[model samples]
Target: MKITLLTVGKTEDAYLKDGIEKYVKRLKHYTKLELIDMPELKNTKALTQEQQKSKEAELIMKKVQPLDFLVLLDEKGAELTSTQFAAYIDKRQIGSTSHIIFVVGGPYGFDASVYQRANDKLSLSRMTFSHQMVRLFFVEQLYRAYTILKGEPYHHS
Candidate 1:
């Protein structure tokens, strides 16, 4: 199964970008992992929060394929341990999922329309993290999940 992380905006910080890239490289060794960055909405100061989210959702939805299993990284979502997350990934690969897409929405979060399109929701932690930081965290978690699955020494109890 191919794993894709779909996020809005570019990683402007050099450190964060480098860190995420490192995890992405590691993930490629275990899975066909890729990052799809949606362009951030420009000149949105005049738009209401809902309008901004609507526009962002439109951009996000366009990137998704019909067969892709969409998973949103939402605050009000299920939280899984590293082992459980590894198991989940394993199940998807074994079940032959065509594509597994995880989306980190814009500042105000996803619109109702985008929520409707999601196949599942996952939360990394109850505490909030910046959008850019969340990207790095999720990618690292994904790399860890793969290492755990492979029984590698990268992850330990």
Candidate 2:
């Protein structure tokens, strides 16, 4: 199965960019992983938080296919251990899920439409982190999950 990570805006921090690139390269050895950055909405000073989310949701939905299994990375989503995450991926593969799209929404989080479209939601941690920072954290966790799945030494319980 192919895994796609869709997030809004770019990663401007040099450290975060480097980390994200490293994991993306390492993840290629395990599965087809794609990271797509949706451009940030322009002139958001006048828009309310809901309005921003609405516009961002429109952009996000444009890239989603009808059959793709959408998963949102949100604070309120289910939290799982590294091994459990690997198991989740294995289950999806066995079920013949063509594409698993994990989305990181804009600062205000996802709109109601995006929430309704998602098949599942996952949380990296209970604490808050910047949206850009979350991109790096989630990618690293994904890599860790793969390593754990393969019984590699990268992850220790």
In candidate 2, what are the lDDT values of residues 1-157, reduced to their tens digit?
8999999999999999999999999999999999999999999999999999999999999999999999999998999998999999989988979999999999999999999999999999999999889999989998998998889999988
Among the numbered candidates, top lDDT falls to 2
Instruction: State the TM-score for model 2.
Output: 0.97
lDDT of 1 at 32: 91
| CA lDDT scores, all candidates in order | 0.93, 0.94
Candidate 1 C-alpha lDDT tens digits along 1-157: 8889999988889999999999998888998988988988999999999999999999988989898989999998899999999998998888868899999999999999999999999999999998899999999999999999999999889
Candidate that would win on TM-score: 2
Instruction: List pairs with backbone clashes in candidate 1.
Output: none
- Candidate 1, 78: how far from true, in Å? 0.5
RMSD (Å) of each candidate, 1 decimal: 0.9, 0.8
Where does the lowest 10-residue lDDT sum fall in candidate 1? 89-98
Question: Candidate 2, clashing residue pairs?
Answer: none
Alpha carbon lDDT at 18, candidate 2? 96
- Per-residue error at 52 for model 2, in Å? 0.9
